[model samples]
Structure formats: C-alpha cells, structure tokens
Target chain A: MYFFQKNKYKIMLVASTAVLVVCIIVGSAINRRKAGGASDALGTVFTPLQSGVTGASDSVSGFFNYLTNMKGYEKENEKLREKIASLEDELRKTDNLKSENERLRKMLDLKENEKDYKTVAADVVAFEMDNFSKSYTINKGIKDGITQSCAVITPYGLVGYVSEVGRNWAKVCPIVDSKVSVSASIMRVGNTAIVQGDIGLMEDGLCKMTYVSKETGLEVGDSIETSGSGGVIPAGIYIGKVTEIKNDVTGVSQEAVIKPGVDFSDVNEVMVIKDN
Target chain B: MNYVLSYLTLAVLFVLQTTLGRYIDICGIAPDIIFVYVLCYSMYNYPVRAAVLSIIAGIIVDLYSSTHVGLNALLYMYIGLAVSNFASTLMKKNVWTVALGVVVLSILYHTVVLITQYVIAGHSGFVYPFVRIALPTAVYDGVVSLVLSLWAQWLSMDKIRGL
Candidate 1:
C-alpha cells in the first residue's frame, strides 16, 4: 500500500509499457495467430459498444441522407421503383440459372466451388483510424465460425482475410495493408504472380504484383484473380485490374501495379469464406 | 470525479474515432483522433495518469488495428510520458506549444512506426512511406491537433472553474 501510494503511477506506466512492448514483439513473432486475451477481452466489451454506435451513426446518417434527398424524393422513388422492377426480372432469371447450375453440378458430380463454400456475413463496426494501422473490425467471431486466414471479400472483389479473431469481433487486414499478400494471376495471359501490398501504392488503394516473368505480356487493363496457390484463399476470386507495370527495385522481376476492384474505403459489409 | 469524466470522454471519443473518423479520411489518411486526445490529455495531466490513460486508449486502438497489438500501446505510452514531462517544463497554455507538440510527435510516431516496419518486419524502405504517408499525415495531424487543442481547452474550463 505504501509503495502503491508512493510510485503508483510510475509503476503502472512501466508495467503497462513493458507488457505492451512484449505484446508487440511476441505478437509479431507469432504473426497470424488469433488475437490474444487482451484483444478478446476488449473486443468482447467493445463489440456491442461499436455495434450500437455504428447503428446510431448509420441511422443518423440515413436521416441526413433522407433529408438531403428530400428534394428529389419523387424522382428517387420512381428510379427505385424502376430499379426494383428490373431487379425482380433479373432475380427470376438468376433463380432459373441457379437451378440449372445445381442440376448440372449433380449431373457432372463436380467438386464444390466457391458457391458451395460456407460464409459468414459481417458488418464493419469500426475501422482502424490511425496513421500506422490499416484494418477494420467486423462484428463476427468464433461463435460465427470465423477463423483466422478466412478470406474476406466484397461482392466486387477481395477485401482481405481475417487476421485476429475475437469472440464477437475480428480484425480484417485489407489487401492495401503492407502485411497482406494475395497469390494472383493474369486473367488474360494466365501468368501467375503474387499481389502484395506496397507502402507507396497502398495510399492509392493499389498493390504490387511481383514475380511475373518479363516475357509475360502485360496489359494496362488485364484482370487479376487469386490463383489459389496457398489454398487459404479459394481460386478465381477477382482481385483487381492492372493499372501499371514497373521494374521492381531488385530489377530481377517486373511488378504490376493493380487497382483493386472493390472500393476499399467504402466497404461496409464483407463475406468471410469459411471452410464448412 | 474528474478522472471518471475524463475516461468517459475518452470512451466516447474512442467510439467516434473508430466510426465517424473514417468519414474525414483524406487521400486514405485519416486523422488520428485518439492521438490528438492523448496529446491534449497529456499536456494537462500528470505523467503517470497520462501514461495510464494513453495506454488504455492505445490498447483500445490496437484492438481494432491490423498492425501488431503492442506497437500503438508502446508508442502512446512514451508519447504520454514525454508530452507530460515536456508540458511541465514549457508553457503548456500556448497555441504554439500544442501545435509544435502535435507536429513533432506526429513525425516521431510515424518515423518510429516506419522504423519498426522496416527493421522488425523487414518491410520496404523508409523513403516511400516517409514521402507518401508520413509527411502528409503529420501535417494533417498537426492541423487537427491545433483545432482539437482549442476545443479541449474550452471543454476543460468548467473543471478549471471548479478548481
């Protein structure tokens, strides 16, 4: 008690700093491991807080959206009605195609593809808003069968994978973060390369595709997809389009700058590809 | 009583930092609201209390961050300690002190992060992140801290009056 009263703050500061540094150093060594106790404890406490805040913000923003769009409510209603009509028509066609696809799969006895994979849909409750970090927290977790290395994707393309899974929240390391790498291939030429985040290109929501042979015919708009080499991420998930090709710093290989298909800055909901 | 209020304020700010802060992102660089909060808090609080609060704030941030868990924690802890120590010596009341603290600390934070990335994680060289991310962000954060410091001062007037 005497010591506590005398140097309590100093003791707390040193102890906490030491603990945090250890978490950083040891946590880095065990990269890809699930979030430790601290994250889980905090996530458990804050997930509900985040969800509630997100819900409130969304509603508040939605109200402002309604207010702003009040001037065009009639036109927007008409457009929405037309869009719904067209969407219903498309939905019917899609239903027919889906049935046909199911029949064909049964007839051919083909292996299950991405469609057969189990997935968990999660809402982004919070973003890592800092200069040094690039991640977002999703309101899903072990209870939802979300595991580490599960591929996260938007409807348009790859978002990233689950890095740290908590009980009710998980941190997603998007492809723009420097630590993530996606095995990618050129859809036009089938030349395989590795798409990884680069510090320079990440600010623009771009990644670098390295290890492409110089002989591979690279085009400005060639589509890139996950090659599924590592087997963590399923094959044939659309990544992005190549925007530029440059000689890597090493000069041994050429690197293609890829523009991600998904607008990462605005991603709100993502599907986690979980192995059933 | 003040400590409770301060922590509650931080909790609310933490939520806002994660949610609403995304909207203010410019060119993929978001304002570090918690960093600003830490700086403001540290400038006025005892070093030990500031360190504890900063650590808590950093942990909350690291919980949502994609980077290694402890990096922000350690960074914020030291930042709190330094800012508080410096605030004791210098004129903590001035706008210049707050602005300079923000700019210097912003640079220091990013530089340390980049170093950790390159040295520890074997990531890319410093030149790219320095020019592309750090410099712009530091400037942005400096401006943001200046504005936030003024607001913080205004908010604390009631406590100052009570004192």
Candidate 2:
C-alpha cells in the first residue's frame, strides 16, 4: 500500500506499457492473418465521414483551380478544338481498322483478351497521411465485389493492388510502397525483371527494377509491363518506363529506375478489376 | 481545458489530417498535426490523462492506416509519457520550450518509425529516408507547433497559468 501510494503514476505507466506491448504482438499476428475485424468496424463508421469531407474539399479545390487557371483553360480549349477535328478524321480510319482487325481475329480464332476482366470504378476518399507509405482509401469495398489483392488501375496505367478491404471501403497500396513488388517485363527486349519499391526512390515517385539479366540490353525510356508471372495482377498492364540503368554491386545482374505512367498525386478515380 | 472538448478537437483535426492534409504537404511530406497536439496537451495535463489520450490517438491512427493496429499506439504512449515528464521538470512552460520539445519528439518519432520499418520489413538505405523525410518533417512540425502552442496558450490562459 505504501509503495503503491508513493509511485502510483510510475506504476500506472509501467502497467499500461506492458498492456500495449501485448497488444502489439496480438495485433501483428491478426494483421498477418488478414483478419481485420476491428479495422472493418472502424472503417464502416469513418468511411462516410471521409467521403463527405473529400467531396467538400474537392469542390473547394476545383473552384480555386478554375479561378486561377481561367486563362490557361481558354488556350487549352482552343488547342483541344483543333485536336478534336484531327481526331475525328482519325476515328474514321480507326473504325475501318477495327472492323478489319475483328475479321482477322475471327479468321485466326483469337479471343479478345481485353474483355476478360470487369472493373468497378471508385473515388478516392482519403490518402495516407504519413510519409513512410503510399496508400489511399477508395469508397467502394467488399459489397461492391472488390476483394483483397485486386488490381487497381487508371486509364493511364497500373495504380496498385488492394491491400485491405472493409464493407464500404478498401485501402490500395500502390506499386511505390516499400513492401510491394511486381514481376515486370521490358517491352523492347522482352526480358523479365522484378520491379520493387525502395524507400529511397519513393519520395521521387519512382521505383527500382532488379534481377535483370546481363544481356537484357535495357535502355532509357524502355516500357515495362506486368509479366503475368503471378496471377493476381493481369498481364501486360503498363507499369512504367525505364529512366536509368545500373549494374548490381555484385556484378552479376543489373537494375533500372522506373517512372510510373500514372501520377499518383493527382489520381482521383480508379477502376478495380474484379473476377481476376 | 476540458478533456471532452480536447478529445473532440483532436477527432476533428484527425479527420482533416486524413482528408485535406495532402493539399498542404510540402514536397510530398505532410506535417503531423495530431502529434503536435498530443505533445502540447501532455505538457499541460497529468501524465496518466495524457497517456490515455495518447493511446486513443494512436488507436485512431492505427485503425485508419494500413499498419498493424498497435504499432502507433505503442509509439504514441511512450511519447506522451516522455513529454509529460519533460514538461514537469522544466523551469517554465512556454511556446519556445514546447516548440523545442516538438522538434525533439518529432525526430524521435520518425527515428523509431524508420527503425521499426527496417526491422519488420527489412527496408534498406536508412540515410536517404532519415535525411529526406525525417529531418524536414521535424523542422516542419517544429514551426507548426510554435504557432499551435501559441494559439493553445491564448485559448486557455488561466489553465496554463495554473499549470
């Protein structure tokens, strides 16, 4: 009783610390098992609030952007009008080519690979606040037929894969996250490599591709795409282009730096591929 | 300050941090507003209350983020305890001292995060992140903490004096 009275605060702190340490161990085990009961409950409550706040902030930012770029919009409109005229002429040629390609595909008995996957579009409701990881929450979730490890993409290119899913929301961890690694192939040389995220390159919106063979002959601006080695991500989804190449420290292989096609900072809407 | 009101404010700030914090990011690094608030609150409140608040804050962060649930909870609890001890021993509690504490604690927080990442994930290249992300964030948090501590002091002048 005397000791307890004399050091009540210190005792409390020690007890709390012990409890927290246990929680850390238990929580990490749960996380590894991908059982996110607590996270899902919290997400159900917070997702609506996040969606509302995101909508309001987007409107505010859109209004400001309109005000600041009025002149630029006028110039862009003029250029787009001229480009539309040329595109219309090109569309006629594309239609003819499409019909011819369909006939050729029928003759060769080839399937339309692009139609194999269905996608659900979702709006980004929130982003990770810390500097260590690159992830965002999308408004669509398990109810929308989204599942863990589903591939996320924009029209531009691959964005990432679903890391966690809740009833009404899911978190997408991008290719640039330190823990994500993708099996990729170089378009020109047709050689495969592993594109892995590095903490050093994440800040610059870049990732590193390693395990390249010595004879791969990688060059600047070589297109990289998913190799379909792992069935999670679909094949031939454009990931990035090589910007720099270097020899491995062990002199047995090479690595290259990649700049992803989709600029994550401005990504608002994403399509989550389903039934993959 | 009323504990209920303080917690409510923290909740609001956390919502804003997750939603609008990216807009204010400087070169892809966002200031940790929740951290600054907890540090300042710990300076003025009892260690036990501060610790409880820290655990709540940490749980909120862990629930929202993709990390394991208790990683941030453990980190924040220790930080809250340390800040409370530092404040109680100080000769005077003011904006300058609180700001300094924020800078120091910010560094400690990021360092722990980096170490944890290295240990758990086997992430390589420590110097790059320490130089690029950790140091700039500490300085940025210090500047924001200065303004926030000043505003908090102004709001609860009597409470501060009593402390």
Candidate 3:
C-alpha cells in the first residue's frame, strides 16, 4: 500500500502510455473496418451536437458565400437571360421544323432521357479541416440507407464517395483527397483515364488524370466524366474538365490536370447515389 | 475553481476550433488552437491538469477527425508531458517566453505528424508536404500563438478582476 501510494505518478504515466498504444492499434483497425458499434454510438451522440454547431456556422458562411459570389451570379444571370431571349426568337422560327427531330430523338431512347434515381440528400455537417487530411462529414448515414462507396454528387458534378458510415453520420473522402481515385473518361473523345488526387494539386483544388493513352488526343477544356467501370459510381456523372496536359515522367503515358466541376468550398447539399 | 475554469476554457476553445475557426484557413492551412492553448496553459499554470486536459481535448478532436482516433491523443499527451516537465525551467513570466515556446512546439508537432504519416510510411514524398503544408502551417501557428498568448495574459490579469 505504501509503495502503491508512492508510485502513483509513475504508474499513471505508464498506464496512460499503454492506453495510448492500445488506442492506436484499435483505432487503426476500426478505421480499416470502416464502421463499428462504438463509432456508431459516438456518431449517435455527436451528430446532433455537430449538426447544431454546423447549422450555426453554415448560417454565417452562407451569408459570406452569397456576398462573395454575388457578382458572378449577377453576370451569369444576365447572360442566361440574354440567351433565353435569343433562343425564344429562334424557337419561333424552328417550332415546326424541330417536331420531326424531337420525334426521332425520342425514338432513339437515349440514356439521357432517363433523369430519375433514388438518392438521399444530406448536408455537410463538418469538415476534417486540416492540412494532413481532406474529408467532410454529412448528416445522413446508415439510417438514411447510405453505405460505403456510394457516389456523392452535387448538382454540378461528382464530389466523392462515402468512406465511413454510422447510424446518423458518415464521412466523405472528397475527390480532392490524395487517397481518392476515380475512373473517368473524356466526354469529347471517349478516351478513358484515371483521375486521381495529388497532395500538391489538392492544395489548389485540382486533380490529375493519369495513364491516358497518347493517341487519345486529350485537349484542354475537354469535359471529364465517370466511366462507371467500377459500377460503384454511375456512368455519365460529370467529373471535371481538363485544364493542362503533360507527358508522364517516363514519357510512356500522358497526364492532365483537371478542375473539378463542383465547387467544394461552396457545396452544402449533396445527393448520395444509392445502388439499385 | 481553477480546474473548472480551465475545463470551461478548453471546451470553448474546442468548439471554436471546429466551427468558426475552421473557416479561418489561409492557403489551406489553419492554426492549431487547442495545441497552442495546452502549451501555454501548462507553462503558466498547473502541469498535471494541463496534461490530462490535453488528452481529453485530443480525444474530442480525434472523434471529429479523419485520422486514426488515438494519433492525436498520443501526440497531445506527449506534448503535454514535454511542456509540463520543462515549463518550470524554460518558461518565464513574459510574452516572449510563451511566443518562443509555441513557435518551437508548433514546428515540432508538424514535423512529428509528417514523419509518422508520410515519411515513416513512405507513402508520400517529404519535400512537397514539408514545404507546402507543414512549414506554412507552423508559420501560421506561430503568428496565431503570439496573439493568443497575449490574449490569455490579458484574461488572467489580476486587474481585470472578472475573467
């Protein structure tokens, strides 16, 4: 009893160190396993607290997003109105002539004709917000039928896919994360390439397309879209556009830098594309 | 009374760190406020309490973080111990003392994280992360801790009477 009382500080330090090591091992295993009961319980409690804080923060940022993007929105609105007026005039002339073309397009029954899917919408409740990692947590999860690897998209394009799930919250590894890779294709030329995030480019909010064949004739401004080869992400979801192209270090293949279609900094709402 | 005050301070700082403080990123780097607080508090006040608080704070941060759960707690515990053990000799009752401590600790923290996450793992090249993320973040932390230490001093002043 005397020894125990005297050695309390030493015991505490050693015990804490041991606990930390055990936590490291268990934490890594849990991360590898994706989700667990403990994390689910933590999420169940923390999701509400995070959501409350996120709601308040979002209100402040929403005002800033509106203020900062106001000019761009005004310019785009003006351009769209002008385009609509011109299109209206053109439609008056082509109204009768386009009837057969529309009929033929309907007859072809293209995949674009289908505009429906089962999706769960979620709000970004929090962000990882550190230089070492780039991820976000959404307020929807297993309770909302979300699963790992489900493609997340904004109205504009692909954001990323779910990496971890809990009862009420999930973590999304965005396309800008160094760990993320997507099978993408050139919309203009049908050339397939792997769009992967790089640590260097992620700081600037850009991704790189690698392993593209030289014969693909990849060019700047070409739209990139998901190829759906993995089947986790649906085909035809817009990824981004090629901004720069360069030869690989070995010169055997080509690489292109892309700007993602979705503005991640401004995204608040996202839809999870659940598999059928 | 002091423990409660410190605990409250930690809680408020953490909430601020996760919420509004996140938007304060410059060049994709944000200051580590909780880290600065722990280093400063340990130097100025109770060491053992600061160490325990750091662990608690680290766990809370890990709960919200994408990294492995104990990575931060482990780092914070070690930082807490280092600061507490050395504070009596190294720290002085001066703003410069706090400033220098924060500066050195911030760089050390980033270096350790980099070594563990990328260098030891060999998954990523060191040059880019060191230049772009780690160094810039340390600079940011230095600037932030300077101001934060000053504010903490102001809050603790006997003349202020209410804090």
Candidate 4:
C-alpha cells in the first residue's frame, strides 16, 4: 500500500510538470501573437524610443567621428598631397606618350603613301596565365576582315602574326614563336639581321637577331625595327632594342639579343596590319 | 488549451534556440531545448500521451528548423514512445533518473539532425558520428535538462499539487 501510494504521487508530479511545460509554451506563443497584433501600440511606443535613441547616439558619434576623422583627414591629406604629386608625374608621362605617338604617326603617314600599309585597331583579351608564350587573343577576328598571315603590330613595333581566326576572336603567334622571323634593321649602322623568336630564350623576354656581323656598330640598348622587306611589317616600326650580341667560335653568324618592345602579356591594344 | 500551450512553448523554445541561443554557445554549440523538453515530458507522462505531445513538438521544431516535412515529428514521436516505456521502470518523480531521459533524447535529436543534414548534403563520413556532434549536444542539453527538471520539480511541488 505504501509503495503504491508513492508511485501514484510520482505519477501526479510527472503529469503536473508536463502540464507546466505545455503551459509555458502556449502562454508565450499566445502572448507573442497578441503582441504582434498590437502593432499600433508598438508603433507609437517602440519606434519613437528606438529611433530617438539612435538619432541622438548617431549625432554624438558624428561629432566624435568628425574629430577623429579630421585627424584621419590630415593623414589622408598628406597621402592626397603625395598622390597629387604622382598624378602630376603621370600627366607628364601622358604628354610624352602623345608626342612620341605624333612622331610615329608621321612616320606611318609616310609609309601609308608608299603602299599596301593599312592599320586597324584591335582589343586584346586573355593570355596564358603563367606561360612565356608571348601570345594574346584579340577582339577582332574574321568578321573584321582579319585573316591568317596578317601581321599584328603596335605603334611601337611588330606584335605578332594572326594565327587563328574565329568570327569574334583571333589568336596571334607573336615574334616570340620559335618559327617566327622578322627582318630587323639596326637603325644606327644600317646593319640587317634576321630576328628569330627563340623558345629557349623566351624566359629571359628576348628574341634573337641572327646574321649581324659581330663588328657591327649595334651596341647594347641599340633599337631594332622591321626593314619592311616583302611588305610584312612596314620598315621603321619599332620591333625591339638589341641588348646582347653573341659571337661563337663557329661565328658564321653573330646573334644580337633583342628584347621586344611589347611585353605581349600586358598588351591590351594592337593594330592589325591588314593592308600592309 | 493544453495543446495550445504546448505549441506555444515549442515556438518560444525555438525562438530562444536561434536567437538567445547564439550567445549561450559555450564553444560554438548549444543545447537542443526541444529535445530536452521532449525527453522530460515523454518520461513523466503516459506513453500514449507522450507520443501525441512528441508529434506536436516535432512538427513545431520541423516547421521552425530547415527540416523537411515530417522528419522531426517522426523522430521525436519515436523518442517519446521509447522514453515513456523506459520511464515506466522508475517513479517519474526521481529527478536524477529523469536526467538519463535528457541524455537519451539529446542523442536522438542530434543523430536525427545529423542524418537529415547528411542526406541533404549527400555525403557520409565514417561511422560514430554522435561521438562528435551528438556528444557536445548531449552536454549542452544535460545542463538545460538540470535547470528545467528542477523547475518542473518546483512546479510539481509548489503549485501543481495544490491545483
């Protein structure tokens, strides 16, 4: 009888607690529902309190922020002053580029009078992410009348030759290709060299100039440009500058190491020598 | 009236689980309140009644959680049935004994969530998942279970008996 009574009491206790939990759940839910319905009361009460406190705090913060921000402004001002100096330097560079472009334009105009030299501007797209394949995709393709064997040139010099042409995109196998050749002229001494793209030397960002005599006046930093033979690229379009001249024991032909003007990787714009 | 309160409590617990629960995160997890609550009620109540309550609680949890339609309802109902049958062995008034209820339910809930998440993600790692997910959840629920169980006891003694 005692054990049964204790069991009955335990049952009652368990039942009541379950009821309590159920009640808490129900009460909170109903209260929340009721609170949600009383939007008018909440709007008049909570919004004003929330917004007023926020506005006041924002104003106070605005004052302190202004002071600290002014100190920041001084640091910013010093930065801005340096940036202004740098910008002035950039403007001078732009002016220099414009003057150089003007002289190149005159030279191009003289070549234009002579014959099939026509130019079309094309935009560059992607390149191999990490390869020394000095090639890039251009926006102009077959649709733009760009066909294979057309030379890609920059105002600075020979870029590449159009290799693949789709309706909208074209690929250029640049002067860096081992099979690629440019008849280059050493401008000062009028020495002629067959500039060949050397795959082994691509890592050093260089192309090769073969057949130049070792005794030629071509020195380090001497410029090389297309000689315009066979109407490939016009004569005097800056190809590259000679950096090294190698004379071997077999020395039938000395090779002048030419670094092309166009990095090819960073070339964003180019001119296609379509009619040239 | 009772059903209304039970649903309300589940909702409140869920809101707490998502919001205030974020702060209570000990090391980046919190107690499964619904699980602890389910455990306690299931153990103390009649087996059939526990099943019914568990269904309701599971549905509420599923609605609030990202769980698919009837998963939580089914899982918790089974837990309710199991716990109620187990609780029959001891007098429900034993506070320490009810704690074991909390542990069982915590493990069940965490396991269900893990399975559900894995099914949705379509990846199954090695076995003994509960050793990682469920174990920590069990610890969290154990603490919550102690507090809620005490409150249940106080309510049972102070006002429930008189009422």
Candidate 5:
C-alpha cells in the first residue's frame, strides 16, 4: 500500500509536470500573438500589469515560484546585492580616475586658452523642494573660496553663476535663467551673439541666443562657446549649439535656439571660476 | 485577526506602487492599486470588515507617504462604504465593470489629492485648468482596473465563498 501510494504520487507529479510544460509552450505562443496584435496588451509577466494582477499577491507568487520555493532568495538577493555593491565601488573608483584624467585634459585645454583664471571645484548640495525652481544650492560657500558672481561650469558647459553665499552653502542660477546674459560666439564661424534668458524658456533648459545679425554666418548645429570679451564668462566656456534658427518678419536679428548641454536635473558637480 | 496580513499586503502595494509602479506612468499618473482593491472588497457581503480593512490599508499608505496622516484612511473608508452600497446595484464580475469602477474611484482619489496639493502649494496648477490631471489618471486607472480587480477577487475568494 505504501509503495502503491508512492507510485500514485510519482505518476501525479510526472503528469502535472508534463501538463505544465505543454501549458508554458502554449502560453508563450499566445503571448507572442497577443504581443503582435494588441496595442494595449503587455504580453509578458514583466510588462506592467495594467490589468490589476499586481495587487494580487497569489498571482505574483505563482509567477515567481522560484522565489517562493527558495525562501532564502531575499537573503541570497541581499548577498548578491552586497557583491554587486563591492563591484560598483570598484567601478566608481575607476570612473573617478577616468574623470580626473579628463579634468586634467580640460585643464590643459584651459591653460592653452588662458593662464590667469583659477578653477574652484564644488559639488551640489540641495535643490529647492519645489521642482519648479530652476535653482540649486551647492556645498561651497564663502569659506570654501566660493563667492557671489562667480561663473560656475560643469565639464560640458557653463552651468550657472553663484548667486547667494552662506557660511557653508551657496545658491546658483544657471545661464539658462531668463535674466542671465552670456557673451557667446559661434565657434565654427566666429560670429558673436549674446545668450539671453526669457521666462518662457526656463522650464525647457533653453536660453535664447540674441544679437546675431541676419547677415551673420550662424546656422543650426553651430557650436556656441564663450567669447570672454566681457570679464563675465571668461571666454572658451563651452555652452550649447544652435539647434533652430528663426527670423521675425519685422525684427533685424534671427533667433537661434540653443540647447543647453548640462541637464540641470542630473547635474552633480560644477566648477566655479574663482580667479578675478 | 489576520487583519495584519491585509495591512501588510497594502503596505507592500504602497511601496511597490511608489517605487516600481512609478515607471508605468500613464498620461503621467500611476493606477490606484489600493483604491481598486478596496473597490473589489466592496463587492463582497463583509461590509464592516471591508471598511475596516480599507481604513487599515489607507493608514498603511499614509505611513509610507509624505502626505498628512489619516487622510487616506478617511478617503478609503468613505470609498469602501460608497462602493459597498453601489456594488449591490450591480453584480457582473466583468473586467470592464471593474475597470470603469476603478476609473471613478481613482478620479475621486486624485481630485482630492490635487485639491490638497493646490491648497498646500498655492501655486498655479496647469495651463488648461482647475484639473487636467484627473482625466488622464482616470483613463490610466481604467486601463489598470482589470488586473487590480483580479487581485481583489483572488484575495477575497475565501470570503466570497463564505458569503
């Protein structure tokens, strides 16, 4: 009887496994068809369950049966995460070395342009709790040699100028601000234009390049770099390039849409030009 | 007294909704999984238990959120009562019905939140109006309702059989 029960259970298990295998094949085929046909259907389990499958724990459990059986998956996951963390730490160190090497190269480029200006390194501290604000605060303050009116830049382009200084913190508003004016010139053709800010363009991280003559050689895709004619931006600061050129019927100058290189949302650090 | 399991489930959903569900933003709003689940429970005969479960779910969500405490509990309790009363008038378990009900409940949830945020922030909302957020959110909730209903139905299967 014991052998009979054991044999019966073994048969049941084999039969179910066979059925499960067939079901999986059929399910995948149906999913492929559904994926091919339906605009809204997310055919796979990973596809966001717009159908409310997620609130159902049983289904999720059924789906992730491997995780359910290996209850130590969370522990295993934690262990693997720690291992990944160590690997990431090594990667970060390597990335830092690469960035340092790049910075040294940029420093060489800057030295070729000018010998007088000193670059002050600073990291971002806080953003206004309101995401609507275009301002971000940084770690450097008056004590860290950061002061008001200093031109802060990232590796890619001119970020902003330091606006407010506290004992340990400073606030900066980027050149994309409607009120900011940077003396910029087209690098390819060397035609001068003033990059000006307007409130309508702030949310999009765009500043208008104004004062370009209609007869000027400025065109779309032209790289805009700092002219440094005015002591403000100190020349050679890589701003963005002309993306669109529009001319007003009555106006003398054509408007070139400049796409700012630094995505302010993801900006981590900036250098403040300190040598005055 | 396994209200603890119910609460834990809601907590898990809230965390998942904020962290993972955020990626699935439809028209810029995620589906209201907790609200839809509450809507599902209101389908059953356990009115008082459903209301209490919803309140617990609400409180758990509040704990995870930066919003004011007890607000979700209050919102969910009323939604539970309303859905319970409404559930008796209709009995079909079709996905569309579940989807539509979820849309209504999600609009209600988000309208309250938008109002709350407007009051707190005191800033201008959008270019178009008093509430453009609710419509997209409602549509997204409708889209997500079929699955959320399945969850509620599955979780409440034992209770449904009891009734």
Candidate 6:
C-alpha cells in the first residue's frame, strides 16, 4: 500500500502506455475487419461538429476568394455567357445525336454498354489533417446506402473509394492516395494498365500508371479511365490524363504520371456510386 | 479551473486545425496547432497530466484522421513526457524556448511517423517526405509557436508565469 501510494504517478504512466499499445493492436485488427464501434461512435459525435465548422470555414474562404477575385468576376461572367450560348447550341446537336444513336442501338439489337449507377451526393465536411494520406470525410454514411469500397466521383472524373464509413460520415481515400489502386486503360490506345497512387507523386496531385507493355505507345496527353475489372468501381469512369512517362525502377516496365480530372484539393461535393 | 481552461483551449484548437488549417496551408502543409498546444501545455504542467492530456489529444486526432487509433497517442505521450522533463530543467520559459521545443519535437514527430509508416505499411521513399514535409513543417511550426507564445505572453502575464 505504501509503495502504491509512493509510485502512483509512475504506475499510472506505465498502465496508460500499456493500454495504448493494446489499443493499437486492437485498433489495427478492427480496422482490417471494418469500422469498429469506437470509430463509429467518434464519427457520430464529431460529424455534426465537423460539418458546422467546415461550413463556417468554407463561408469565410468563399468571402475572401470573392474579395480577391472581384475585379476578374465581371470578365469571367462575360466569358461564361458566351460559352453558355455556344454550349446551348452544341446541346441541341447532342440531343439529336443521342436520339439517332438510340434508334441505331435498337435497330442493331445492341445491349446497353453503360450501366446507370445509383449515386448519392454528399458534401465534403472535413479532410484528413495529416499529409501522409489524401482522404476526406463526407456527410453521408451507411444510412445513405454508402458502404466500404463504394466508388466516389465528381462530374469531372473519378475521385476515389469509400475507405471507412461512420453513422453519418464516411472517409474517402482519393485516387491520389498511396493506398489506392485502380484498373485503368488508356483511352487512346485501349491498352490496360494499373493506376496507383505513388508517394512521390502524391504531393504533386498525381498518380502513376504502371504495368505498361513496352509495345504500347503512351503519349503525354493520353486519357485514362477505369476499366472496372475489380467489380468495385464501375467501368468507363474517367480518371485522368497522362502528364509524364518514365521507366520503372526495375527497368522492365514503364510508368506514366496521371493528373486526375477531379481537382482533389478543391473537392466540395462528391457522388458515391451505390449500385448499378 | 486551469485544467478546464487548458482543455477548452485544446478543443478550440482542434476544431480550427481541422477546418481553418486547410485554408491557410502553405504549399499543402498546415501548422499542427494541436501539436503546438500540447507541446506548450506539457512544458508548463506536470508530466503525468501532460501525458494524459497528450493521449487524449492524440486519440482525438487518430479518431478523426488516422485509420489506426494509438500510433499518435503513443507518440504524443512520449513527447509530452519528454517536453515536461526538458522544461523542468530550464531556468526560464519564453517564446524562443517554446519555439525551439516545437521545432525539435515537430521534426522528431514526423521522423517517427515516417518510420512507423514504413515499418507497418512498407512505405518507402523517406527522403521526399523528410525534405518536402518534415523540414518545412518544423520551421513553420516553430514560427507559429513563436507567434502564439508571444501572443499568450501578451494576453496574460500570469497565465504563462514562467514566460
């Protein structure tokens, strides 16, 4: 009893340290299985708070952006008006082509090549605070039919996949994260390749497409799209355009750096593809 | 009362770090205000209290940002203990000393995180993160700590009696 009283602080320190080590082991196990109860509870509590803070931050940033770009908005508005008129004209032509294509498909008895996917749009509430991984949290979760490994995308292109889901929030690991790998194909060459996040290229907002055959000619401007071989992400989703090509460390395969169509840093809203 | 104020301040800093921190990032690197606050608090408090608070802060960070739970908790506990020990030996605490503590610990923290990442995840290429992230973040955190410590000194002399 005397010893316990004398070394209470030291005992507490040691006990806490041991508990943390055990927590690490248990946390890793739980993470491998899926989001655990502790993570879910944290997510439930923090999601609303994070959403409110993020909304406030966005408003503040938006106001600052408006102030800084006030002079350019007038010219931008004018340019956008002209672009809208041209796009309207193009839309009419596109509508006609779509109907003609539909008739041709029916006449040819061709099955649908593309599957219409059910999607849930969610607002990005917060981003991972560290630099190690490229991830963000969305306001939608399992309640919204979002599950682990669900493909996340924006209008521009593929964003990433759902890594962890909470009650009211989910963490999205972007395509640029080192842990993400997508089965991709060059749109121009039709050659399949593996698009993976590289630690070296992550800071530059780029991913690497590897496993390219030497015979396949890859150009700097070649577009890449998901091939959907994994069954997790749907096929024909635009990923990015190739910006650079380099020999792999093994010197046997070539790798191409890809700049994704979605601006990951600026992503505010995303669509989680639920099912097809 | 002091402990309550400290925890409240830490909570506010946590909120800001997750939200406003992204907007003010310099070259995709933001100051870890949570780390700075924890370090500062450790330097002025009991080692046991510092360690406990650091664990709480680390767990909060892990819950929000990390896939695993205790990596940061372990790191922060050690840092808090180390900083407490170092501070006890010091004759005085000031902006420069606090900034120095932040810079040194920031570098140590990143290095440990990188090594842990490499060990667990097989993530190679340490030189890039060290050069691009660790070095710049250390310097940036140092500057932020300097500014914040100075502000704290200006705000209430008794709050940071040593400073």
* Candidate 1 structure quality by residue, lDDT tens digits, A102-122: 999999998776467788899
lDDT of 6 at B11: 75
Give the lDDT of residue A20 in candidate 1.
80
Per-model C-alpha lDDT, please?
0.81, 0.84, 0.78, 0.62, 0.62, 0.83
Reference-based TM-score of each model: 0.84, 0.94, 0.86, 0.37, 0.41, 0.94
Error of 1 at A148 (Å): 0.5
Candidate 3 vs candidate 4: the TM-score winner is 3
Return the lDDT, model 4, position A275: 67
C-alpha positional error of residue A190 in candidate 6 after TM-score superposition, expressed in Å:
1.9
Regions of model 3 farther than 4 Å from truth: A31-33, A61-77, A83-115, B119-123, B150-163
Candidate 2: regions farther than 4 A off:
A1-3, A32-35, B151-163
In the order shown, the candidates' Cα RMSDs to the true structure are 4.2, 2.0, 3.9, 23.8, 21.2, 2.1
Instruction: Give the distance in Å from residue A120's predicted Cα in candidate 4 to where it truly belongs.
Output: 2.1
Write model 6 residue lDDT over B1-163, tens digit each, in one string. 6666767777777777766677778888888788887787777766787788899899888777765689899889989888877786763787787898799889989888777774358654788878888778888889889766654344333434343
Give the C-alpha miss distance for residue A83 in model 4, angstroms.
16
Candidate 3: residue A30 lDDT (0-100): 62
Candidate 2 residue A90 Cα shift, in angstroms, is 2.8
User: Which model is ahead, 3 or 6, in terms of DockQ?
Assistant: 6
**Candidate DockQ scores, in order:** 0.57, 0.70, 0.48, 0.02, 0.03, 0.61
Better structure of 5 and 6 per lDDT = 6
Instruction: Tell me which of candidates 2 and 4 scores higher on DockQ.
Output: 2
The clash count for each model shown is 0, 0, 0, 3, 9, 0
RMSD to native, candidate 5: 21.2
Candidate 1, clashing residue pairs? none
lDDT of 1: 0.81
